[model samples]
Target: MGRKAKYSYEFKLRCVKQVLNHHQTVEAVSELNGCHHTTLHDWIRFYEKYGKKALLPRKNKVYSLPFKIKVLEAIEEDSLSFSQACLKFNIPTKSVIMNWQKTYKKSGIKGLNNKSRGKPKSMQFKRAKKKSSKPLTREEELLLENESLRAELDLLKKLQALIQEEQSKKRKP
Candidate 1:
């Protein structure tokens, strides 16, 4: 699911109308609405270029590598500003294009490839048990038994220490 917008479409349209139709200045409208002037200006521009649809919340789009390259090329070839590039390409925000430019500069075309978000499938909290067809030797079995015994001893020691601490605290107060 897409994230909810900070400003509703109606709110943006009202702000934009205050600036465009009411002859109010962008800074004045934005200041009154408690949003940045630049943000209000972008809204005005988007409204002008794409109408009310531009004010609606947009779904997160996964741009293909080729499409990213194309957008980057257009930005470079046309010397378009981030805002202009976003408006031209119908991208949701200028920061998205800015990040693309930074990634392209830092890692080249390979960086433009879409990466999976969130934890990878390979990550696991609990390790999988090893499976082997061969039986364990006597020495290996003895080593495993010793390890388990040591772990149990450590856990018992901790529990004993915690109990003693509680008893001492109770005696103190």
Candidate 2:
């Protein structure tokens, strides 16, 4: 087995940028970076082809529609198996193709964009919580009730003081 090649994000971006600037062929930059010529060519093609977006790290289980379309197109053209398509595109999952196929079958192209498969019960609970928090836990309820009683008592005490002050003034007069 061959040793794995590694390049930092900055180094790869620099190499790709240099290739796009046309200062040197991809072959030369790949040599300088100790990367495979084909790898550098693909990197340059990807960078030139996709711009800044291509440099972003991909999320698992998320493939762009264009990339999905390309995978499907390749599969259709070459009658490639899932594994073959995965190898061809360096796609992360065979399941991704399967998911796309499932989505396409159900709702066509619009289905390919990000979508929730179904409303989970937990999601419903979360929504409910947002709309109104669950009734406070027993301890919290008791605390709130105690606080409310204290506020009412404070108001009552102030009222009693005002009444006592009025009676005292009338007696003085």
Candidate 3:
């Protein structure tokens, strides 16, 4: 599928201004600007309610735990399906709510917290710890990491020298 269409802030502002200040109907302005009726309607609603701040496009959405629980509870108590809840609450997708439900079931409310989704950055490679060994102290770990990096650099230098020696031997022959 093609990438989703993105509208710029200036474009949105100009379109919204045409409808708000110029006394033009949404339908007429939308037709003139080649925007759909529903998109224009949503823009008008954002402009009316939250002013211009709401008009800017947002990439990241951080939903509160309470909101997630409330939505799930509403679905349960009201006997509404995922699609129904999504439409009623103006949510983008059902999978988001479903994932939240799964996390809630596995780890209760704590799983809903926003955390980094990948491995932490460290020079030391991550390996499985032996059950009998205690965890290394921070300073000791840093020393080990330094030694590992130094060894890696030394090995690379040796390989480079060996490659140059081989090239020289080939040229001479």
Q: Rate the local accuracy (lDDT) of all candidates.
A: 0.91, 0.73, 0.80
Which candidate, 2 or 3, would have the higher TM-score against the true structure?
3
Clashes of 1: 0
Question: TM-score-based ranking, best first?
Answer: 1, 3, 2
Q: What ranges in model 2 sit over 4 Å off?
A: 1-5, 62-70, 78-173
Give the TM-score of each candidate: 0.70, 0.37, 0.48
Q: Tell me each candidate's RMSD, in Å, in order.
A: 5.1, 14.5, 9.5
Top lDDT model: 1
- Minimal lDDT window, size 10, model 2: 123-132
Q: Looking at candidate 1, what is the lDDT of residue 104? A: 95
TM-score of 3: 0.48
User: For residues 1-173, could you state the per-residue lDDT of candidate 3 as single tens digits?
Assistant: 23353777788889999988999999999999888877777777666766787677665577877888899899999999876676566564578889988998999889988777567877887797566577889998899899999999999999999999999999997
TM-score of 1: 0.70
Where in model 3 is the C-alpha error above 4 Å? Answer: 1-5, 71-173
Please write out the lDDT profile of model 2 over residues 1-173, one tens digit for every residue: 33243555577788888887768887788888788876666566556556665554554545688887788888889999876676567663468788888888898888888766456656333343343566778998898799999999999999999999999999997
What's the lDDT for candidate 2? 0.73
Any residue pairs clashing in model 2, and if so which? none
Model 2 TM-score, all chains together: 0.37
